[model samples]
Every structure is written in structure tokens, then in C-alpha cells.
Target: MTTEAETLARTVLSVENLSAWYAESKVLHGISFDVREGELLTLIGRNGAGKTTTLRSIMGIVKKRTGSITFNGDQLIGRRIYEIARKGIGYCPEERAIFSSLSVKENLTLPPVLQSGGMGDEELLEAFPNLRSRASSQGTKLSGGEQQMLAIARILRTGSRFLLLDEPSEGLAPVVVKEIGELILRLKARGFTIILVEQNLRFAKRVADRHVVVENGKVVDILSAAQLDSDMERVQSYLGV
Candidate 1:
């Protein structure tokens, strides 16, 4: 049996010396990491540690950025957001960006399907059973978990196999968080490569294969599930958990 670390899958996303800024303020300072095909990797850090900026930079949402972010041998630098999305990478931002005026079904189907294999509305709704019952309700009518599910489902419709998920478990009830975790695992089972940004280490450990530790916009360490287990105390001390 092949292990998660022993898999021969090629590197799906390679990031090297990545840096980005918000106006005059520089955030990421040459952060670097690589994710393999079908692997679930997490960027774990405290608030304002540039985890979200890293995701934005990958999607070309952070305009003033430098360094190489390659997906399947395609360079992501200088690409437009639409171009990136169309290149088979989906991004689910931390804030559930569902339109308040739109119904749940509307929000789920809003993003254009970027490729041939993108999941349809029916498939996504089926995967997120909570969304099925509330399909006709306005975005504001749903709970936090439902909104998060809607955000993730919206991206799946785009047919981007590589996903950059930002804090999918944030501000949710325990049961809801567990549901989200199960959903992520299901997606992983379907062969989607995922890069997750998370503050919840416990949650991250549950779903992630490996973790890249970020501090002040730089990658300080990378830990596997076993390493993270043995070093839990040290990791938590630095994370301020």
C-alpha cells in the first residue's frame, strides 16, 4: 500500500520565493512550498500571517506580486484572475461571497464552468445535502455553514480540479465543522488537489496530509501528520492556541 507521502504523484503546484503586497504594505516575504497531486496541504499560521495573501497571489487576485507559482508547468505570474480560473484552479475565499439577493441555487450556479469536467449544479447540491433543502432560500437566510458550503460548491461548478480553500471551517459550530471536513475528504477522494489555509490546527490535522507553517509571511516549517502529532505541543505554543 502506498502512503500519502510515498505517492509518486508529480508536483501539481510549485511555489518558490513568492512575495506580495497590499498597496504600499508588503505582506508575503518570499514564502515557498509545493503541493503534490491529490494531496491536501494546509497553510497554518496566526492572523495576518499572509496565508490568505498566498492564496490570492496564486489566483492573481493580489496584483503586486512576484515569483513563480506554477500549476502543471504553466506559470501563474502576470496572469489575470479569469485566466487563472480558466487554467483549472479554483479559489474559495475566507469570506463566503454569496450574493445576499440571490437564492442558494443562484449563488451555487453563478460562476462559469471553466472546463469540461466541472460538476453541475445538481451534482454539487447532491454532495452538499444541506444545500438541497435550502436551494430556493436567499443567501442571507442560510446559516454560516450553509454559506460556506455554497461558496465551495460554487467553485466546484467551475470544474477546477485544483482548489485553494481559505478557512472553510472558520466561525462554524462543531458539528458543522465536522461536516465540512467530511466534505473535503470526499472531494479529495475524487482526486482534487487542495491547498487549504487554516487557523484551526485540530481541524487541519483532521483533513490535511501535510502542513506548511507560516510566520510573518515566511514558511518556517513543514510537517507531516505524524510530525505534527509528535510536535503538537511546540506547534501549538507558536500558534498561540
Candidate 2:
């Protein structure tokens, strides 16, 4: 766990006036936020409030986006998805898009290693014991928790220092949700900057260092984990939880 002072010193990603579109419909209307190195932050809001679009825009997956996304002091306004990934940003969407046609091991080894220092086979297995046991199992055969684990593990193998995870704990059982929470804390300790999109405010509270509350396609509030505790009522009103 990093102190607030330490987190502020590293500023990793800055999103300024970011607007995005799905065809002609605007989803994110000039939302702005910053992510600090080694910090785990969450974008929390009701469904359709544009949290997913925010992550997609930062990852350069949303093509019709307009804004200045500065990462490590470089502007990422018009970079392609692969270009952004090569620059060390990994995205694990809500769908947990691991290939259903392949074995777990095959899915793990498929993505091109974008940089050095990625987790090797041993490390990946150690972090996720379920995957270790199901190495040869077909992707579709695993449980939802296992699939989410595989999605996260595959990204860790990419050596990407930054990660964008959308709704990782959604539709998960209580025990499995707890496991995901623990894994997120472990990744933060390993020094990965993460921007998470989560609807479960309780789960978000357990894992994130800060929370950015979105409503109607824009940033309505930003609170530290400490601030969130003292101002729970206000934030809950925004989330309608």
C-alpha cells in the first residue's frame, strides 16, 4: 500500500477533456482524470455512465475519441491499439476475452511478448493456482472465476506496467470476488498502475487507492479511499447503491 504522498509523486497517466463516440453517439463527454504509478484507482458509476468508454479511450481501443492522454509524458491522442500496447499498456476487458478455442496454456502463450520482465510460466502459475491445475483445460470449460484469472494472467505475461481492467468482479460469487480482490492487491504491490471500472463500490473500496465517480458521461467527483469513507453517503447517492 502506497502513501498518498508517494502516489502523487509518480503521475503515470493523465486524461484531459477526453470525449469518445460509438458511431455517432457520444459516450464519454470530456472526462478528465489522472492515474499515478503504482496506484490502484477505480472508475465507479451506474451502468451506461461511460466508465467502460473511459478505459477504452485510454487504451486507444475507441477510435473515435478526442483528447490528450499523456502517459509517461508522451501524448496518446491518435495512437493505434497495438502501438499503445507496445508502449506497455495492457487492457483486460469486462468480457474476459480469452480464446475459447484453445487450451488455457495456449491462450496464455499466444499474445506476443511486448517487452522484457514479463512473468514466466512459473510465476504465472504461482500467482494463480487454479490456472496451474487447469493448464491443459479448454478455455470455455473453466468456471467464470477461472476465466477471469486467465484473462489477468495473460496480461501479466505481456510485461505491461499499466493495466486497464473493466468490471473484473462483476457476476462473481462472494468467495471468488474475494480472491480477485486479493490478486489485485498483489499486482499493486508489484508496481502496476491500474484503472479499474467497477460497479460494486464495496469491492472497489477494498482494492482501490482512489475512486473517480462518473455520472452522465462526465467526472462528478474524485475521492481518496480515506475521503470515500468519510463521505460515503454522497458517493453512494451518485452510485444509487
Candidate 3:
């Protein structure tokens, strides 16, 4: 069993009583969670449950946010989005933001390095082999799976230790989804801490160490991967699946 001291030592990000809003509309309501170093945690819920808002709140994208967001011992609540990113936190939005004008290679190398630990070009190419073949192709020219891979690959080049991935498996084929899952597992093995926002429960169960269930903008339950099997009824109710 993991001891308290070990868990404390391993925690890389902590969010307590986090609330957020867009313009006048409130989204996340006093949600709290912690992501341990190198652990893959997923935020699971149906539409409008505020899973995406929680990620936006963490990245400092949501301007009107309350409560503590501590990452690597640094307070992130008041920081700018770019500043938060500079602190080694990366956000990959649901849209899979890939610059259409830039080639795959250009897009991959475009992000300014945030830290010294980023993977080199060759290493990155090795990890995402599909990228190497499409090096000269425009970013928007790639298929959905390739675009998703490039979106994530660019972040790896930025040297971000903690990644906030939103809807990575959404609208992808089963084979491609499996590939993405394999990639996530590889990242976890390489010590990349990730918080994934996913509506796909099957995909979440495949890669996440824990699941944080959200409903009506609040965290309703936290379950381990093991507990997921036995607690399906409750999970389904929260997800309305």
C-alpha cells in the first residue's frame, strides 16, 4: 500500500474548492482534486457537466476562477494562461488546435520550450512514427488521428510535465482510439502526469488510474480503476449512460 508520505511527495498538482465562470455564467463549482506525479487521472461526465471547464480552470484559461490551483509548489490561480504554460503545464483542447498553415514538422517545433527536459526532434519522431512520414504535410492535411497525434506531440516538445488533455478519443475510429490509448500508456510510463477530460468511459477505463465523476459542475465521486467495475451502477447514474 502507498503511504501518506509517499502520496504527499508524489503530488504534482492540487486543486481545492475550485470554482470558475465564463462571462456571467458559472461552470465549475467548488471542485477539488489532486493529480499525483506521473499518474493518469480522467474527468468523466456527460455533456454540460463542467469537465472541460475544470480543465480550463486549471490552465488559467478561465479568467474568473476561485480557490487554489497549486502546481509543482507554485500557485497558478492568478497566473496568466501563457505564464501557467511556462510553469510546465500544457493544455490540449478538444478542438485539437493544429495550425493549418504550418507543416507537421513546423507545427511540432513551433512551441517555445518551457523547460530543459523536452524530447528532441528525433526522439519525438520515434515516438510518433506517423509524424515522420508527414513531416512536410500541412497540419490540417492530416486525418483526425494524425491531427490528434500532432496536437499531443507538439506539447511533448514544449517540455510540459503535466498535461491537461480534453476529449482525446472523441470522434475517432476504434483502431485509432486504441492507438491513442497506447500512446497515453507510453506517456504515463515515461512519467508524464496527465488529467484527461473524456466522455468515453471505455477509453477512460483503459488508460486512467482514477476517475473523477462530475455532475452539475461538481465532483460527485472519485474512483480507482479497480473500483470502476464494482461501482458501475453509481458511475452510470452520474454519467447518465
List clash counts for every candidate, in order. 1, 0, 0
TM-scores for every predicted model: 0.96, 0.96, 0.96
CA deviation > 4 Å runs, candidate 1: 1-7
lDDT of 1 by residue, 1-241 (tens): 2365546789989999999999999999999999999999999999999899999999999999988999899999999999999999999999888899899989988899879899987888788888999999998789999999889999999889999999999999999999999999999999999999999988999998889999999999888878898899988976988
List of clashing residue pairs for candidate 2: none
Q: What is the lDDT of residue 26 in candidate 2?
A: 93
Residue 87 Cα positional deviation in candidate 1, in Å, after optimal superposition: 0.6
Each model's lDDT = 0.91, 0.91, 0.92
Clashing pairs in 1: 118-159
RMSD of 1: 1.8
As a TM-score, model 2 comes out at: 0.96
